[model samples]
Target: MTAQRACGLSDLVQDEARRVEIDGVPMAVVLDSNGEVHAIGDTCTHGDISLSEGFVDGDSLECWAHGSAFSLRTGKPLNLPAYEPVPVYAVTLDGDDVLIDPSVTLDVN
Candidate 1:
């Protein structure tokens, strides 16, 4: 899979989400509290809101509109109003660069 540079490792703050678009696909890249990076579909499963605008709680990202929490690792919804899971992309780190493959979506079933 082709990996596109999303942002620098320093550009991401812990427990914050960043909105990015790669290959015309909207994505949400997050740096969790443990200093790990995660990439997922930006749209929330429950609504049309962007997940990047949501709050990051540990490994889960909570939708600001509906409070739907999704796992960063699997993209599975952990709360109500969102029964469907979003696509979780593959993230790689090359030194201080954060790369994401929009074409590769990890199976979260």
Candidate 2:
């Protein structure tokens, strides 16, 4: 599938996560403090909670229910309770738009 507009750049706040679903695939779109945009799976691997509703610290998104921190860049869980890594999608910036393709994930290894 092609890249679709997830949200506008103005809709995102630094160090915050916004949940966006594309083609039934849920994703967490984050804009870090460094002005970099990242897209990762929204569901917490440790629980059924949404990762977008969690905390964004630096480049990682921490699960509020289990304290499992997932890297926004690699999508790998940095702590216990969640060893499974989430899919990291490539983010595209088109003017004020943030585009992402759910079928296209980055090989962040």
Candidate 1 lDDT over 1-109, as tens digits, reads 5999999999998999999999899999999888889999999999999999999999999999999999999999998999999999999999999999899999868
What TM-score goes with each of the models?
A: 0.96, 0.98
lDDT of each: 0.94, 0.96
**What value does the lDDT take at residue 64 in candidate 2?**
90
- Give a tens-digit lDDT track for model 2, residues 9-85: 99999999999999999999999999999999999988888999999999999999999999999999999999999
Q: How close is candidate 1 to the true structure, as a TM-score?
A: 0.96
Candidate 2: Cα lDDT at 84: 95
The reply for model 2, stretches above 4 Å from the true place, is: none
Q: In candidate 1, which residue ranges exceed 4 Å CA deviation?
A: none
RMSD after CA superposition, every candidate: 0.8, 0.6
Clashing pairs in 2: none
